[model samples]
Target chain A: MTRILVSEVGPRDGLQSIKQVMPLEAKKAWIAAEAAAGVQEIEVGSFVPPALLPQMADTAELVAFARTLPGLNVVALVPNAKGAARAVEAGVHGMSIPFSMSETHSIRNVRKDHPAMLAEIRAVAEIASAGGVHFAVGLSTAFGCTLEGAVSEDAVVHLAEAAAEAGAQEFSLSDTTGYADPAQVRRLIRKVRGAVGDMLTSLHLHNTRGLGLANALAGLDEGITTLDASLGGLGGCPYAPGASGNLVTEDLVLMLNAMGLDTGINLEKLLEVRTILRDALPDEPLYGFTPDAGPMLDYNERIAK
Target chain B: MTRILVSEVGPRDGLQSIKQVMPLEAKKAWIAAEAAAGVQEIEVGSFVPPALLPQMADTAELVAFARTLPGLNVVALVPNAKGAARAVEAGVHGMSIPFSMSETHSIRNVRKDHPAMLAEIRAVAEIASAGGVHFAVGLSTAFGCTLEGAVSEDAVVHLAEAAAEAGAQEFSLSDTTGYADPAQVRRLIRKVRGAVGDMLTSLHLHNTRGLGLANALAGLDEGITTLDASLGGLGGCPYAPGASGNLVTEDLVLMLNAMGLDTGINLEKLLEVRTILRDALPDEPLYGFTPDAGPMLDYNERIAK
Candidate 1:
């Protein structure tokens, strides 16, 4: 069976966009439940300043709690070297920094231009390497940008080369604006792979325009292994304007398992974890069709049969 | 440009599952607006008995009105020889009949088993041939059925062959219960084609599990051309329990156009058509991401750039 790494980014990304912070206990329960459900990787939190995003203020605590789960790959987002240092100190297994492909978006998001962001990535790579942590640079807005519009494919390839040269261990192409389609996904993945070889293995996609799963399918066709998704697709990035939730984790897992790919996720158990979020964040709307519709009637039979 | 035939099925499929009967004028307006938006084909309505589905009672009237539009290939669903005769009299450019792959679903949907359904297909095919109306057989529940779990792929291929032998001019695989995944879609399309050759050209998928577009992408990968979608994913078949809605047309067209495929659909004009359905069916809910989020910022540049 083909195995795909489904990286859960709900606790960090999903909570980041919400107005109220998820209670720490609820966060711990969500992470533990997901880990128990065979989700091996979880982006527990971001090491950003608490002042800018209070919802992520409890990220370090989440990291610590998630790390206790055996076989769980605890990961966090680090926007700069300062955040990278904090994440390393938090003892995260992996750290990813968003490298916006659009210079305009890069400045607005991290308050750094391309050169400065590259330097920061270098600095973070050094810190993560020293701390024995896996570090990845996420090419955010790689598809297109709302602020700048039409981000160039050449620029994305060039930046991947630069980031790889800057000591980035792995790369993730992010459709932060949900502007990606399957055709672009297939073409871009091949182009970036041409630049950085097999380092480009992950994809961070959005469903704002309803092509998230389709784009992920394209990524899979190009041999992308790790896919980032939020439980219920609850989060839209604050920095990416008009962006909606990341691909719904439940839906993505459902499709993966249905395709006879082993995601190691027991979908029913993963679904139960949603109740914690529901009770904790009562007003927040959870999104995903598989959860609403439940698994297909012949869930065990698989789609191929 | 890779021209894709986006056959709008909202008038027939969308209305079939709804509770309230749409006014004839509203249906006319919806069909006309979509045609004006450059949609070349539309399944105007079903020719079922009015008592069974009053929502489709206006199918003949719709076919008459839709045929008036230049370049519009007006179509309707005919469940039996009687309905097929009526569809022929109504002068539809095309007519389709649903042939459920699962016998349980077939019995429940149309009160016909495989052998009986084959007879019905032969009778309707003769009528369609005599009347010079283009006829298609939609292999409903080809993916899997709610009534029966794990529909055999061999069964689907066999039915397509049987239908073809019965004079089905063309064949379409329908995910009536939305159990299809991308891998299964690619596999089944190839298998059915092995049995029926290139005559299997269209896909009628449901978005129940959020894999609708992904499955469509898989079909596209296999060179399947025509895609069936509803205007807003508004209707689902009342017969196919647990089935939600057909693939949303607005989102599908947006993805197709974004991928640089010529769908001939002016998305902005297509979005305008939703207002007619919204106003005419005040209580009905409209579903689609592109309409809710509008098109991407760089909608014109296409994803490849």
Candidate 2:
């Protein structure tokens, strides 16, 4: 069976973009249900300051709850050494740090330039390494930047090499502004892998331009094993106007299973988990096409017989 | 330059699915605007009786008006020999006859089984050939049918062979119910091409499961030149409940352009045409991510510079 790992990031990425806070109990239930649906790994929450993002204020608590689930790799998002320290103490299996490729976006989002962010990544890697936890540096705006019109390919490859050298276990290319196309995706993934080799691990994509799944397929064609997606496409970029949230996990799983690659996810069960999310964040608009149209009859038959 | 043919089917496919009828003048303006935006082919309307689909009643008149536009291929959707005769009289550049692969869908849609549909296709081809107009047989539900659980690959290839033998100058496979996955698309296109060679001309896909553009890209990879799409994703399958309309022309063009393939379409002008569509059919929802998020700045720069 061709296996692919779908890393769920709704708790951190999804909740951070929304205004409403999902209560702690609902968050726990959501994570448990998703794991039960066969999601192997999940980014439970982000270790950001409560004042900056109250929605993710319960990250430490959520991580503690998620770790109790059997056979689940509980992950968290960290911005700096402080966040990484908190994540390591919380005993997360892995922690991801965002490193922006665009100079303008880097300053606007995290108030740090490239070199400063690289130093922060190195510090976070050191902290996570001391705790014996896995570390991944997410290359944000790796495709293109909203503020800085075009992000250079060389800049991205250079950063991947730098991050790998900084003791980062893995690097993930994120279409932070959703400007990625399939050709660009294939080109960048090949370029990064050539530079950093096995250190380039995953892709975090947004459907902002409707190329999310297409771009994901390009990554798959390049033998990418890990993908970051959210349930119901939960998060939108608050800073980038009209950008969509992460690729919908349900849709991604459906496409993978249909392609005969094993995601080990029961799509029907995964869709059922959407109700829990909807109940927790009632006003948030959920977006996905598979749940609406249901699976293809042929796909259901192939799996059944 | 890599060129792609984007065949606009919004008038026939889009208007047919909706309940509200767009006025004749508005339909003409919509076609004219799209043609001006560099869309080469326009499916101006269908030849079905006005009583069956009142929205397409002006198809003959629209085709007449569309033919006057220089370099624009004025196409019409025909159901049988009668429709083909009318289409030929209208001086259409091309006429497409839909031949449903699923028996249940064929009867429900046009009251004809495969054999009967093939006979009609023969008749229509004869009429079209006599008039010096091109004829394409659209294989509806070529992916899978909602009523007929699984459409076998063998069944699709068999029909393509028979259609080629029966005198269809072109055979366009359509995912009428939107059940196609990328792997399935690549598999089927390769199978059909192997069987019929150049007889397979285009792909008509739906974004019902949000895989429209993905499937289209798969077809493109197989060197299938033509693609059928609707402006703003205007059409839906009335029979297939919850199935989305055709692939959005604007989004498809954006993807093609981003991949460095040229469709000769002006994205900004195509968007402006959406306003006319919106004004004419105010209640209808226009779907596409490009119009919402706008094109990538890098894509704009690459195209400009």
Candidate 3:
């Protein structure tokens, strides 16, 4: 396929960064709108505990609602075996468990060590296989870590191979702290892709360093077919202070379509989805260039088959 | 110099599109504050008649005031040979006269045909030579024309060569209607650079097509050094309802700086200039990303020499 599928992660990745927590039904509406916009897959919610991340407590309900959509693939983030069990039982199309390469980052983000994370990946994979849900491992800090600094690409590639061996069917590289440049991105992605082979490799990038889209472009140039973006530039990193984490979905789709790549997403309808999220979280800021710039006169319309 | 010059043209290109005319003195203050922010070059006003463009009556006075600033390259837009003469007399560092290759755009904008417009460029060149001032030619509608549609790349390359031959020290490609894409930009820039070499370079782009930054990135990849932007994403063609012209200067510079391309601009200081423009033209809308999303903490300190 010439068109790469752009999966929006605003509700899950974007919402938790900001202080505002969207209600469950409002999230369902947001997911429904994004589904209508032809977003092939969406990370609907995270399965983090309510005490830890109050913003994403409605994962079970939201995933079930998203699954009802005809062609939409519902995805969820699971931190450990418990969240993985919930995601698999809730019937999400795909489940991703994060593995931070940096030992320090693993402790800070998940309260687990590297070996514990690897064991948890095996647990999540077992749950996914039994429940018939897709299993993947997201290697955050695959490029560089904010806490420790200078994550080697060798460790990242080694981790991907480890996750695959642990029964993870897919692999993804994320620039968790956004320290990636285009050159670094090309080098790392090439290395990772070569290691992972064709296990549906993808990227989950944050725009913390403002290299989000540029790094994403590098990934695309390296033959990556799956990209994760938030509707607005809603990266919302806690350490980042008033910044959106993921690259802006609208801007990324615009870039892909304008380059003659088939995204199968309508620019106008996708922007309309922004209004749905805006209504739900009125205080949270939404960001993207294309919506503000408006669609070009010849923006191709998308037919949701 | 390795530093690229990003000239802000919002007060002129941006305000002229609005029905309301921003006060002349406020316009001057905007330029002044922008210069203070280390915006070395600012297109303070356009040299159009008061009846046609009542928004910019005090351009000559603005140019004079802008010249008073230490180490700033003050610029003005000259529509024809007459505006060039005034700009030369006012003693601005540089001025640009827009030449539309599209016959329909030329007729609608300046009420002249292509051959006659060629005569006007010759006149402006002679005036600049006598008055001892620098003159550049901006070929507007170089990408495509709204009225005539699908402007030929050959036509743009030829006009660029002719402008350079007629004593234009610098030439800027105008995507007056924002009809440029990245691949198209790489192709056309390569074609023009082949024809006119370094003399035919610089980009005056619009984000109307949502491809402004992408087109700019493509231009940079092709070794383009100078970029023209308006402050606050201001400016549109009054005749063309939805057509905004000129990429937002602050946002574009932010992208370049974040990419480690030195533009000799401090983002925080550049952001301060937006407030002056916003206060001056309360009725006019200004657009920029970096202003809303504050600059990275060590950004200026890290980049500063």
Candidate 4:
């Protein structure tokens, strides 16, 4: 059976987009439950300053807690070498940084342009390698940007090549604005892989336009091995109100499991993990079709059956 | 550009699933607006008895109204020869009968077994041929069923062969319970096509499991051109509450339009059509991610770009 890595991103991407800060204990429980449900990797939090995103204030603590779980690969997002050092000190298994393909979005999001972002990626790579941590560069807004509109595939390929040359071990095309379609995904994956080879291994997708899973399938067709998703479709894009931001992890897992691909995750236990989120953030709306519809009849017996 | 036929089924499939009967005028206005937006085909309604589905009582009137649109191909669903006769008299461009693959679903949905349904298909095919109307057989529950889990691909292929031999002009694999995945869709489309050849041309998919668009993409990859969708995913499955039913036309068109496929739909105008449904069925909820998120930045310019 072909194995696909479902890297849970609810803790970092999902929580940062929402204003509510889940209690630290709740975050720990959420991560623990997901790990127990056979999630092999989790982006537990980001190393961003608490003042900007209080929801991610517990990153170091989460790293500490998640490391105790056997076989769980803990990941954290970093903005630059400064944050990368903190993540490494906290002993995360992997660290990733956002290098926006749209220069305008980059300036607005991280106050850096192409050159400065590459420099940061270089510096972060050095720190991560020294600490024996896996490093990945996420090309945010690689699809299309709200501020800049259509991003060219050539530009995405160029940035990915630069990041790889700058010592980044892996790269992901991030659909920050949910502007990607299946054709674009296939074309971009092939284009980026042409530029960076096997380093282009992951896709960070959004369900904003309801094409998230289809886009993921396209990536899979192009041999992408890792997929990023949130527990629920939480952490919606601030630019697009009433739109789901992250692809719901449960929905993605259901599709993967139904396809008979080895995702390692158990559907029932993964679904049960949602209750922890529900209790932690009562007012926040959770999104996913599988959770609402329940699984197909005899779902357990049908996984990769 | 590859032209794909996106057949709108909101007037029939969507309405029948919901309790509220959309005012007839609203339905006519909706169809007219969609046709004006460059939608070429629409399943106006089903020719069921008024007492059984009062919601579809005005199907003949809808067919008549829709046929008047210069470029619109008006279609209707029929249960058997009796309904097909009414549809042909109403001057429909096409009429389709549901031939369920699962015996349980066949008996429950249309009160007919395989032999009885094939006889009905034969009768309908004769009437359709006499009237010079296109006839299609929708293999309902071609995917798994609520009562019977994991439907066999061999059974579906066998049924498609029988339907074609019974004079059915075209066939569609219907995921009535939304128990379809991309792998199953790709595999079944191939298997059924091997038996029925080009007669297997359409897919009637549901979004009950949120794999609707992904499944549609798989069908497109397998050379199936015609896809059935509802405006706003209005007609939800009765068995799965809080889960969307039919593939949302707005979302599907958005994906197709983004992939540069020629769906001939002006998405801006298509999104506006949701208002008619919103007004007509005030109490019922509408489902779709595109309408809620609005279109991607510069979406109009991005169509088939």
Candidate 4 docks at the CAPRI level of medium
Ranking of predictions according to DockQ: 1, 4, 2, 3
Best by TM-score: 1
lDDT of 4 by residue, A1-305 (tens): 89999999999888887777899999999999999999999999999888878888889999999999999999999988999999999999999999989898888878899999999999999998999999999988888888877887788888899899999999999998899999889988998999999999999999989999999999999999999999988885554334357999999999998888899999999999999999989988998899777676453443323
Candidate 1 similarity to native, TM-score: 0.98
Q: Candidate 1 lDDT (Cα, whole model)?
A: 0.91
For this target, which candidate reaches the highest lDDT against the unseen true structure? 1
- Per-prediction interface RMSD? 1.7, 2.3, 6.8, 2.8
Best by DockQ: 1
Looking at model 2, give its docking quality level.
medium
TM-score of each: 0.98, 0.97, 0.82, 0.96
Query: For model 3, how does the per-residue alpha-carbon lDDT over A229-252 read when each residue is reduced to its tens digit?
Result: 999877455643343457889888
Q: Which residue runs does candidate 2 get wrong by more than 4 Å?
A: A298-305, B300-305
CAPRI level of candidate 1: medium
**Descending-TM-score candidate ranking:** 1, 2, 4, 3
Chain A TM-score vs. truth, each candidate: 0.97, 0.97, 0.93, 0.96
The alpha-carbon lDDT assigned to residue B75 of candidate 4 equals: 95
Reported per model, the fraction of native interface contacts reproduced equals: 0.86, 0.63, 0.14, 0.71
Clashing pairs in 4: none
lDDT string for model 2 (B1-305, tens) is 67889999999888888988899999999999999999999999889888888888888889889989989999999999999999999889999998888889999988888899989988998998899999898988888888876787888889878888888998898999888899888888888889888889799999998888778878887888999999999987787666667899999998888888889898889989999999999999999998878776646563342
- Docking quality class, candidate 3: incorrect
